[model samples]
Target: MGLRKRAAATVVTLIAAFLLPLAAQAPAQAAATAWTPGISPLHDGEWVMRDIPGGDQADSWLKNCARASGIACVSVGQGDGKQSIFHLYKCGTRSLSNFIDALSVLNNQTGGAEVRFTGPNVGTYRAPANPNVIWKFPNAATYDFNTMSVC
Candidate 1:
């Protein structure tokens, strides 16, 4: 091949080598931004739950939810006296519903901690002491839940 053609080919190859990785990374960067908590409205199926009682049990629940493939993001914050706050974002309806189910199970297994949730489309739910009882929020998009002390 001619030297000019070779040089052009080399330049094109170098450009592709430099730009391809960046193009591949663009989606990941966008996904990271999309998952950022509280930056966007919850209308896009994002959700947050706060005030979950902190302890071994809460930790287990958080871990389980984080492991779930449907969950997009999970954030936990510490509070006074083993209490905690949790924010779950970019969750599908099925995943969030399943999470609530699991949380009810956890509540019952933990001897009935009062779990309260607050958010858009979701009303405040105060879980009773019965294991069979589950709070129902049909239209809830985003919510926060915490364990309330029963005194």
Candidate 2:
């Protein structure tokens, strides 16, 4: 074959090799997104089911969580806006640190420390810091994260 054709073939092979690994890694990276506690179907005390209905607030429930938690939290509404479940993690100012701490504990056999925010004064803290935060869908979602604020 011509030198130009040979060169083109080599370039295509190199490109495929480089892109294949990244494509394969995409799912793993996305899997980590939902690895946060409570969502895992495997854990017992680590997860629970709650029911809350959605009414008006529909566009940005996570934003509503930020408003309600009085700290920082992210959320996802269920059943096409039927309910909402918030994942309250770091104080927002420190998500990177919390993610690192959580990943370490989750990857370890020791599991992770469960943080108990039972008292009214018990505010949002980093993961491994506040592992027991309300993550399940609320019993009665009023509309957005306001009613479902993580614990």
Candidate 3:
């Protein structure tokens, strides 16, 4: 009986010891990031390029815009710092794939062509025509742009 009681007590102690630290870390883990709903970074008619690279290889299609002087490209920055470079054609709107944590956009369009980003609430925001310019969103998941219109 004594040994059983001791074994039960030891098991309880071990369980408590393991769970205490996790409990302590639970709040921190549950804490929301800057991109979370605690604060919204996007506003109506706000330019997503107001602020500011690459791991995974998720290259999107670069079809149809070949008529332009230079190839226009766009890259989406993922939350884990991985990026997907998309070759965009001009004269039409392209829908983006479902990407996780789109933190930034790189407008690598040439010939001084601006890439227009359209969202539901944010309206239309045009990226700079300058090639190789990177635009970072204010938060990690701020701008949820639906389509890109390269001109």
Candidate 4:
């Protein structure tokens, strides 16, 4: 090849060699720092309520959530009672403790209705009146909340 052509080829090769590895690593790096939607890094707790109909019950839930100082609530979507979804995340430094307290209050206010949580972890819980109940879900990786009845 001519010297000019050879020099240009070498430069292209060097550029690719330097850039390819970074391109390959982009996904892993992104994944490591990826943010889970509807969950906050600053907050240590999350809850989702799904399929709630718009009514006094939904209004009450939203009201209570808003009243809490550290809780953040998002309406994921709206639909018929069976299709609505609400997501709540803890935004306070003391969120986990506060969450339990809120849950206890909810349990009392709603009369122990069944609260269902689904995601990487799935379970059903009834809020106990006792604020001391040790409610722990260390795996906050992912979750969705749903309740057929008022909770």
Candidate 5:
């Protein structure tokens, strides 16, 4: 092959080598950042969900929510208590934090608003507003949640 062609080929190869990894990481990076807690609140009511990292943190948050009044809180995953907690105070579709293991959902909206969980394949689960109640879903980690709705 001619030198010019060889040089151009080398440039193309180098560019691809540099860009491919970035392209591959783009989705993963977005996914990582998208899972940030306290990022999106869908509704105009008091709703909270904690993305717990470990069983220990889950236990702690559950106890805390039990004592809190007039606020709905949900907890997901058995994480290290590093993920942010979600807050919703309206009636709309709310984005969810990263799921590690397990889940707890609470609906504390006034006028009997309901909280709904939608998964791509697992369908939807709805919980009505119940004060001082925590809806625990231990198998929530297996489902891929698309959006959470409160109405």
Candidate 6:
């Protein structure tokens, strides 16, 4: 009889022991799984600039502005202090594809400011905040801006 009681007690104890860990862990597990906010870098209204070659005399100044501001000078129409367009690094190394995506995004967000990859460098653009729009050909051919131009 005593042996039977001991066996039953052992089984119950084992079950209780296993369940205790799970029961204790439930609240802790829930807390750990919950997400805590504010882990990412906040860049609201903040931007960086970069200069890509191809723009005429103005290119140098834009490059300087980007360098001075401790950002990047990725391409043209970026560094001019007059426009104050907010630019940023590609979060990492820049690739041609990434630049294309960036250009598309910038052009889309900034109200479709004529996003011209400069004809001068088919790889560059004369992008700005607004008011100025010019597409330059590799031969320095420029498509003058009128009212119907893009950003």
lDDT values of the candidates?
0.40, 0.33, 0.48, 0.37, 0.61, 0.34
Candidate 2 lDDT over residue span 1-151, tens digit each: 9999999999999999999999999988865553222332222223222233343333234334434322334333343333333333322121111111111111111134232222123233322323224333332221211111121
The count of backbone overlaps in candidate 6 is 21
lDDT of 4 by residue, 108-141 (tens): 2223333223332344443232222322232231
- Over 41-145, each residue of candidate 6 has an lDDT whose tens digit, in order, gives 214533443333333434443444344322332232322222222344323222121121112113222433333333333334444433222222232322221
Models 1 onward score TM values of 0.35, 0.32, 0.46, 0.30, 0.54, 0.26
Task: Write down the worst ten-residue block by lDDT for model 6.
Answer: 96-105
Candidate topping lDDT: 5
lDDT of 6 at 5: 100
Worst 10 residues of 3 by lDDT: 33-42
Separate clash counts for every candidate: 6, 1, 4, 0, 16, 21
Runs of candidate 6 with Cα error greater than 4 angstroms are: 39-151
User: Over 4 Å off in model 4, which ranges?
Assistant: 35-151
Better of 1 and 4 by lDDT: 1
Residue pairs of candidate 1 with colliding backbone atoms:
48-143, 49-144, 50-144, 50-145, 51-146, 52-146
User: In terms of TM-score, how similar is model 6 to the real structure?
Assistant: 0.26
lDDT (Cα, 0-100) at 124 in candidate 5: 81
**lDDT pick, better of 1 and 2:** 1
Compose the digit string of candidate 1's lDDT tens values, residues 15-111: 9999999999998776543221222234454345554554565555555544533332233332222222233333222213212222322233233
Q: TM-score winner among the candidates?
A: 5
